[model samples]
Target chain A: MRAPGGVGRRWAPVLAVLAVLQCFTLLLLGLGQSAHAGDRPRGCGQPLPVAGSAGFANAQAARRTNVNTYGAAAIVEQATASQAYSGDLASRFRSGEGHFRLTFNDTFGAARLLTLCDDRDPGDQQTVMGVDDRDRWLKKDRLYEQPLDLYATNVYVSGGAQAIGGFYSASVTQSVLGYRGAMVAGQVINLYPAFFAPAVGNWQRGDGVASYAVDWVAGGYLDLGAVAARVGTAGANGLFVTVDERAIGLFGTLSRGVGEAQADPLAYLRAGLQGFSLRRFGAPRLSEAIGQSSLFFRDMPVGVDPSGDAELSRLRTLHLDQRAIAQQVEAALSYRVGQQSGLYDVHLGWHTPGFYGERSDLKGSVEAEDEGFGIRVGMIDVAPRYSLGVQGGRYFSARAQLRGEAITGMILFNDPEQLALFPFATNALSLRLVVDLAAGG
Target chain B: MSRSPHRPQRPARPGRLSSRSLSWLTLAAGLGCTQEVAPDRFCQEAATAIAGRTEACTGDLDLADARYAAFYEAYTCVDVPVESMGEDTASPIAPQDRLHCAFAIRNLPCSLVEAYGDDIEQYMTASPICDTLVQPKGGAR
Candidate 1:
């Protein structure tokens, strides 16, 4: 049955009341220029691993039997994307990389290197903005170096069903400029419970990650990890020092077989869930430094407190707990088969706020607008993704495999009115190819 | 019938190389061991230096510059809509909400474009002065 068309009519009064309350809270919070939260980059647009559950098992087995061993081919992958975005800059990206692993002393392991370079141009971004002259914006024939992954991993301990490891990886990305208006004269009115959508820009980041995992005999596993990152933007102030901010977070994942672990461990009926929460500290100092950077051309415009009074100082030292940044949850189902096996698995998963968040400033424009916001926004709405894959190879003869995946129901927020709205299928579609090269060949 | 295996006989040889030959051998071994460890380190240093290079604007900010003047004319005393500002990507306001510009500049300074030369494209896209002003395809409004 269709719902009434006048739903907004009833909510109009409630929203009016909220608007009043929002004004009052804006005074108490003394909000000013806010920064983007969350340690994970949004919308890298890389393809998920093929045949979700099965791929996990295959990777785990590879880690145990063939990974990090001296003189072994270990693992190699070649990937490309139709389009990828870092902050505001978007580009067509391609990557070719491999892992040269060395295993020693039985359980101790090390992946000598994990490296990839992401290349994208601001030209497309310029075009989307309507600039026809490439030379006007691009001073030289050059490409921006976007780091995909560049780090090494060490497995300090390993055994039959569990392992622990830590990694030190450093990479850079862009964070775009986000503009807001002021509520009071000469003061930027930033309110608590501030709404944010991802924009295209650069945010350079480097961090250390430590992870632990355990696998059960029933074709299931649990994984946990922590991240401490130094994230910042370019120093526009000419001093050439990065305006740095610190963030820390905890993340975990769990997967179990829905039916049963097949006689062949490679084949399984399984499902998995994953989530993360990240908090940024020292915001007050970072924002001030950024304002001084060449990026802003000036200090953070004056800020107002939650009590509706001018309080420029509040912007610098906001509490860590007060800033509950981003929390993400994801679930996926995947199936795989041995050349000899058949129909071994199935997966279904969902993530909230789906894939893309709305760019609130681009409210009316279609390119960045999300008409689904009014319905339901943020991580509560699961953007569903799925994959199916197959594998064949022996240790020494080398292994080769291929798979395909589809992600549906993701809400790309661009419009202000679409808040809390459910995403309908639109231009959101992607296809991916994965190749694994193993040892022996 | 059995056939005998062929074996070549050699005359007696010297027990050691001549002095001149030995010297040459030692030189060759020394050259082989020279791995050029420092060159690898130097390459890394050079690459990082280049990566860190950025362009800077020359000359002083001229208030009369058209771009700078335009910024003042449009944004000064105007309520600009701020959906998400700064690094905090959290609870944002709805569209149609407009905030006033605190800085009283007449135009967006050309220095901004020059100072952030690498990201000029982003500025062009977002800046009112350089915006293409194309409408959204669907009736999103």
Candidate 2:
């Protein structure tokens, strides 16, 4: 079933008719070409052996050098209100993060496979040379002096081999400052990879893929790297370390042709399950608060001990000391015809307590000067997300996706009063648009 | 070898050949037909080879001899300029240098960077690759 570019899934029946018509048209075109050739099609006799052909060589060179530029602009609207400089409650808004990515892919070794199921054919081994740069600037509300900037570049070589029963693929990358997925200024999204430390802050990762057919493709991956956890001065003031800032994830997908191939608009129904566990251990460090440090504060308030006598004077920094594991399971029904694609899916996710909490400990009895300075390790819940993704275009590609998460947990609200005022976490609406500069129509 | 009695010998036409001569001629023709990779194909292969080496995992410095082969091949084919990093140079002739240089910058080991940095720097600074990014149509170096 194929529908108009960017059309929603509600028009599945129309798309099915269009897809059948398109296929018929393609069949007629193929028949005409064969009739004109006065012979059956056989890849025109292997492209006349490309070696020594200047035009062929030039085409190959062009493909190798082709650079695809991608521009993405996203705006996130959250339910929370901002209380920045003034105590006045201000409607908080997260506006723009403009990202530019340059991607170059070199294909060689074997002819490209048409589908993941092509692995069963054992004739379409391919090697891919990929490199990309992702750079972005995030604007946040009154938290830091400078806008948060992220720059990541990676070069990876991936090769896929079609073997008996299936195809196997593997790749190793040397990356410098690489971060993947949706990353917000103060938000950490679950279910992704982080690199191992000591490789370079840029981090390196390896991924493997196996596909027996379109219906059965599986992947497992791991990334290791220490992420810098900053404690704001209004809260705890210290630079702490994450002992286990690593992530490991596994995902599997199964898709099978559904309905009558010729009459039913539903072509394939697919489902995927993925789970990830991320753990970070932060070590406590000794630090001082205002009016407590004898060297820093010359005029101590009454009952304030410059000699560390006051219980509130000693503030030691401790992190949430958390191990978070989150799981996502989703099933999507897609309608595709021509070059247009539409997908509607039901997404379910489970998040453990401490998965989203960032807290620090106050070692002394005076209680940490910051009101929010402890961890809540007892909350967990499952939430459902409804999302729609549409993609259209032949050469230059455009993809728009919208996902809404029904809030089931108020993890961001710390104070009981605040929780009472805002019984649920703000509903999050994420919208993103990506434009590919080097697409062909 | 003796000719078969049942085979009647035909008169050779002018410029025609005996069996032995025909065999030699065919052999010569086949030898001359040895396939040579086209220039564009060579460049692509060179880039892929270079990328392969660049992506290979090396600890400290994988100084393995094979690793540099692709880099050297790319350097040779892409015509890396002898000019210094900031020196003005002509637009790069080999477009693959853009891809290869990106690999070097993003994935190359620090040890190899020390060895190859000068060349990579020179090429990237004068690279037409960057210029093509803004062009309505780009990719050709």
Candidate 3:
């Protein structure tokens, strides 16, 4: 006789893989190449229409919205800094080495900087930080000769369209760790200056407003700052200034209709390349450098769960303290195929490690939404390990869109001992009910 | 007190081209290979190239139209002579460099600008070759 629920447990992974493959097939079938070669609006000799003041204003507004929405996603400061700390920790400590490990993590608020207006009310600025501190000591020598390890990850994100003057967004992450005389520190700051906004105009698209703008980005990262501030008898403070004056970002948004149609955007895309000038002048102990290049694009139908897609994208890119300092590029495309009283939504995404590593993954999910009730199931493959998760929720009313969602997942194809070591990966469940009563329903 | 056995090793510095040197190289190239083209010829070539390339890539005539209009307005390409433009500005872009900027915009790969048609405009403004077309007063070559 088989063990109770053994068959169901074994079949879950197979079912998840099948569902993802089916979505991929559908996506490929739906892909269509646009053809409009013979269409030319005006002759080369004829002068083009001049954009009026109102046109310029509308374009600026569109630019501001796009910047506030997709700016933070362009910054990889937190991911880069966190990876530095994890790299240092992994190199020093090993699991099951008879070492006592104590860990503490506390997050004040959800870090929803990528899509600022999706979570909260539009124009509401939110600041959040998460701290994870870990300490390890030798268990055998309890009295003396205890090798102490202390490290902390701090992330700070703030900015919105409602910010003073023009729109502003900033993200900073600092990682510091000390093991005896050896100390390492890494900090990344992404700043969008108020004056960075450039003149933009909307391109007349018949029924929608489409605008694109490029902003000059100026920010620097301090990699391995004070790496060995106090090493042995010789102590020398080190500072790494990595400035990228030539950094530039491109943001674009397309929205259908006019006034009310402008409330929801149809497509959003942003791409940025930051080339840093690394200069080492003063006498310093040790330093490690950091650089980033990212491309983000999201196309989703209106009236669907935007926050859900954002959260899903965030979870896909959330590397924790495991991934190395490799370049990362992620893109998500969601489509609503059918709608009756309910809707069928399929999201397809692909993420690849940029510049540094050779690990890439494809993720897909299918969701059914009907009468304010929704359920989604998805899977993400991270090479040797993969996790399958199911999320279900419902909306109560229009003004008060109360949603109670519960997500549960487990690492199906991974080492049992590894799962035991990382308890969070083994059959984890989280439930949250959010109620928003903000103005303007 | 016994010292920890594993002292963290200093990470090796990554081998990457310095941005400062890259900027200098770009400036040197611009100065050494400055080309001179008539204003009318420059405008005609730029308009023809941008219109063909942008239309082929995006299939959106409105976007192509807007880009052409923006480019004309930026360089005063519509019935404006090269002598009158950038007269008061110091270190004006050499006539050949201006044409180079136009060609660069025209030659932008479809793969780079296909995702968003409007991005072509951004590339025109941000690209080192194209940005020199509208240089600020006393700007570097």
Candidate 4:
């Protein structure tokens, strides 16, 4: 039976093909021919405007975030080690029999699954890593700074933006595994170090005495430590992630007590949380962009022919990467609500110790009691999309971000999966003046 | 196993034991020998005819395109030879392969390429796979 107009025409062929293929096995797409086999893909998104202090040194090479992030650390101990190579690396990479290729649709995993049916909140790519950082390091490459040395001169470029924001705005963006939850949640409340705050002097509605510096409203929070660890270890070809074993805690408390501490019923509640705060070694630059070429060592087995001419089957190349790590934790707190004179966003979070994603870290945030109450006017956490693609949770970013949009900024822990759609993660504290329109409102 | 003296096994004696082993084997070998004597016998001719035609059509002498070759080596593939009444395939080149080959040899002298440059190109596209034998060869287009 045919339908009316163009609809029927389009579907008729498809229906016929499906019906024929279903009945006759010979009409398969591949006809049983195996797919090409070689290497798994390396994935990295756009630059995240999350790290205000970080230079976009590697934004051009998003995949290389891990490599450059580790810098001299990757060779801290490997220096002076005897170098040895047996054969051409590529030549040794013979395709295994029966190996096949597999392709993943955009936004595949938990996040996509959750948002698959939802019309709003499309996921997208964010957080770029590339620039001056080449994926190489001597046994001891010097740090990057003024009075450049032999290591810094040949190691990194002077271009690229810094990472500042995170994932929470991954709107319809797809990954190999359908936006699996990498870093989906966090909570932060601080006025300073504000990478994405509105311009200070553009006060359209307030006086200097009681000014509104910034306002944020986030609803999803994914685990940054888990995400940093997972995507960081994607391949030995990029950066390396190391979790500290020390039982360090991230303790933060924000309290405003008045003249009489005991009699002040208006004493702001003090919230403190302690644990390990994770850290990550941003990967090295990936992909050839701008004016750049990746020099790779070709390894092909030497083949002999009857005519004395050598034949090389195929050429294979490997891009090596080196990295390093450090210990640090990021924590923030404020009054849950605005006081008579300022803003307050009180919160409790559990974090593990050190650099990027920590191995052991459990963090959660308790939003202000009246955040979603119908009576409240500034509450916007309705039907939020989490990094896990879960509904009704605050979106959070869990990695150092390098947002490329105007008003650029960096976020320490933006969920790649969630921010794959939303630009802000780590906490539901949605802020104003974000380049991503989705997060601001 | 013991055999009945009265009803001797069909393949046990009185026949070419070298040619036949058992009832089933005997039948298969019998057919084989029959074809050797009369090679054109339908069943005997079918297998070689089917195989030769496929190889000839493939044009490739080796595993150059292993991806496509795997299809032929597949367990489920079927084979059928061109019947005497079947269209003459002695042309060596399939109609389509001919056009592609012709275009591939464009500009070469005394070849289909020089004779019908535009026409060959229109039919075979600008380039043809290196193996086709269209003319003026030298791995034309």
Candidate 5:
């Protein structure tokens, strides 16, 4: 199905868009420059945990688990192609030297960090994250640290079932030239692009079944809590703090992801039918100040109003309702005794939920076992929600694949895109493979 | 230019064919083939094969693979194509092909080789790839 007038050559102008963007970030990183006295922003905090080391201990781990369960990973569901990118950089391991995540509890207290935004853009981001390099291997070299005080939210650029590279947003990756953040450990995120079709996921609450969050003012106020997991021994624990943009709203979002155990399938399934919600709030001034420290992933704010203007109005950067907020989630469950595939994960979600006055939702998707992969289908019975999705990609090996659709409909209520020339659409496809770097002895 | 004190001295030239074999190589690798194969064996095997047979074969598409992440590793490697005209004159690469250069220059200045990638036809061209490119710091000295 071709759109109107000759669209083939129209793609001519698309060649350098990604490269130009890459360059823009490069220029921001200033790869060739040296450290300047006042060049980099100062927002780095202490390092986080990596592969071998337990990241969040008891209290921290538990707190993070709740956030994850309550839907933090879901924020990374949908992403766009314009910014869908992921990779990593590493310093060879020394006996004592290692890598880490630079996370700051405060904007100015510590060093630099990754600043990701879950903007109000209707649909345009594929991956808005900076992940640890894929090169880092356990006992070899991987990410040693994460950015401090970063705001990461997943958005659906194109809805898909597989979460290969869905979450999209930019983050400060490196420092200006020679100036490294004062924090000992460096920071980097592997911003890979996910490819898959979009549809309602597994679990879904009945229309208005889940209670919506309470309302709050758009100011310096933020909701935070600690998540702790058992670090090495019972003696210590790892900590992860969840930061949400708004205090309330009930909207669902979508993404294409795969995992040993999809983060939380039920959460995603529920969101697919009921989109998530967002109340507008401006990025913290400190968020920007912290970002200014590094050249990599350094993006200047393009503040504007919904009326197609750059005038900053309303308390929060812009008056955001239901349209602007979105999500991306990766959920999987992995136990040994794997039969067909070494690891099998029932990817239950990655959807945009309804947040504007709609009740929480109940949604579910089923992957029909067919060819090497399966036909992915899903539905939602949310009170009021509407979205579009199409995904096609490989979940595990290049041979074992998944290529088909399951759902595209208005789940519960009103969709804002009634009059737009084309309704919102999300599409994806990915072929994955595995390679052995080190020989098994 | 002054050499850095930390940089290792270049190794004396070894057998031209000193390279590793791709035996059932899966894709998850991140490093280019780092197996320490003796070049003599590789050259001998090639010499034994007929010239026609050699042309019919294309080298492995996977570079620096890790078993666990072969799929991801392949996705990460970029393929930048270029043409070598006769007498050292090279043609300007297509804009799409030049993306590797842009990527290497952008956000990843240090990984020019990884970002720019190997020419698709170079392996078949039978040029001394090992002799031309320097070994990355991780390889055996």
Candidate 6:
């Protein structure tokens, strides 16, 4: 007789490939539609929407220059026009134009109002304010203030199921970046599945029963001595463990333009519903279950008090009982300088407490890299962890390249109590070899 | 600049080091070669050093009048059982070493403190004299 579940096992890889192909086809279709729609001009009297308060701040900064030439009357007229434009934009955003319209409806509107009155463009004020003609000044002013106006939309789908030896993993991501204004905003959907099987002796029978069932069936035989030997061999050869973990995450990002003069530096905000899962399976031990669950799934309610329940409070402190989906937000200000051969960038940011379950630290990162070699260093404050990553690459052909990367972290300062519960070892290192098949290798 | 007991003296002819050497030295220091000190003494010394540095740096009359009350309150030593400080049974901070680290931070030079500025807490833990506060069980250090 055929082995049990053989048909399903044989079809798994084919099904996975089909799914990936379907996703890519949909992504390509979306891209074509978005590209066609992007070029269409806004309705008459509708000022193009800008990203968040940074856009308004740029407008205000430009207005200070207008005061000298156009005078108070022009400012008053502009204000009236701006209010009407904002109201219309807000209504359209609520009506849902893009994928993020439903997700970030309230957030986008709220963020647009977060105008920092003190934010000023530290560029050549004279040139910004200098406008010779009063007749076409408003149109010129708008053009001058905006750093980026090229509206382009793109959708990318990458990664699929892969099985190498005993290791099995599948990850797929669809990212959509579109132009709403001068800044680019988008949403990403990621599906990740974790599955692994050891190459050791068969742990399961043809009928899907564990091998231990045979011992149990034979007159309740208990082999304690043999159990230890089996475990030792399993550990040495890689344990007979299967983790059925799957997570789906949604992410949204909003950014401000770097300004006409400041082309390299950009300030952005990002928020995500990072892996909100309701059910999980296949973890045998409590620690393993907790660790796996914590990695991709977070289900704790945000901005609520759990003080009444002592157990809940304890779990939150240990980051254990997370079963309600919550939002994690990050804001970063970054600057980058690029050359023909290489580029350097630095960023400073803050993450909400318990952000993505663990990375709640105020962080700063610096990366300086070229085509052949690169290095990145990131420092975070909570555990005071310092992540160092080094990458080296070699080009095989015009369309093929190979790269190797090594990443490690050092916990300079840590709370011993916290470390005991969530073991983040400083000695852990990750090595990866990536092969790139692209046009520009 | 006038020197104090809390501040380490710089050599009259300070040896010049290349940028690469300086980077290596900084990395080595960050790796942490620490010395043990009594907690109470460390607290006292740290508080004194901070108070003295604040008085020297501040030009604000109101802050001077307050005599940096906040700094003193934060750095002041409190009596607590060593076990209460950490929950890790495998490796915990030795009470004496923790105290010593505290003292060393309190005695850091004004220049060094100013250089670190907002990142003083991070520097303190990563500092050579304070890094070994957390030691394996039975105070192996």
Tell me the TM-score of chain B in each candidate: 0.19, 0.23, 0.41, 0.19, 0.15, 0.31
By TM-score, the candidates rank as: 3, 6, 5, 2, 1, 4
lDDT of 4 by residue, A1-441 (tens): 334565455335434533442332222111111110001001111111111000111111111211222222222111101011112211111111110111001110111100001111123112211323221111111111110000010010011111111111000111111111221210112212122322222111211111122211111112232221101211112222222112232221111222434332111111122222222122222210111111122222111111122121211222211111122122232211111112212112222221122222222111001101010111112122111112333333232322221121222222222222221112211111112111111
lDDT per model vs. reference: 0.18, 0.19, 0.24, 0.19, 0.18, 0.22
Tens-digit lDDT track for model 2 on A111-175? 11001010111132223112211110010000100001111111111112211011111111111
- Cα RMSD to native, each candidate? 33.4, 29.0, 29.3, 33.4, 28.0, 30.4
**Residue A430 displacement (Å), model 5:** 25
How well is each residue in A46-79 modelled by candidate 6, as lDDT tens digits?
1222221122222221222111111111111111
TM-score of each: 0.15, 0.18, 0.20, 0.14, 0.19, 0.19
| Segments of candidate 5 deviating more than 4 angstroms | A1-14, A31-441, B1-141
| Candidate with maximal TM-score | 3
Off by over 4 Å in 4: A1-324, A327-360, A365-441, B1-141
Writing each residue's lDDT as its tens digit, candidate 5 over B36-128 gives 112132221121111111111211112211111222222222222221122233533321122222111112122322333333222212333
Q: Model 1 chain B — which ten-residue stretch has the worst lDDT?
A: B97-106
- The candidates' DockQ values read 0.01, 0.02, 0.01, 0.00, 0.01, 0.01
Residue pair clashes in candidate 6: A299-A323, A299-A324, A300-A324, B39-B99, B46-B106
Model 4 DockQ, alpha carbons vs. true complex? 0.00
| Tens-digit per-residue lDDT, B1-141, candidate 2 | 111112333455688455345434422221111111222333333333222223232211123233333344334443232111221326433222333333333333445534554253232332334223221112333
Instruction: Estimate, for each residue in B71-104, the C-alpha lDDT of model 4 and write its tens digit.
Output: 2232121222211111333433322222222222
| Angstrom error at residue A131, model 4 | 49
Most accurate candidate by lDDT: 3
Higher-lDDT candidate among 2 and 5? 2
Clashing pairs in 3: A327-A354, B35-B96
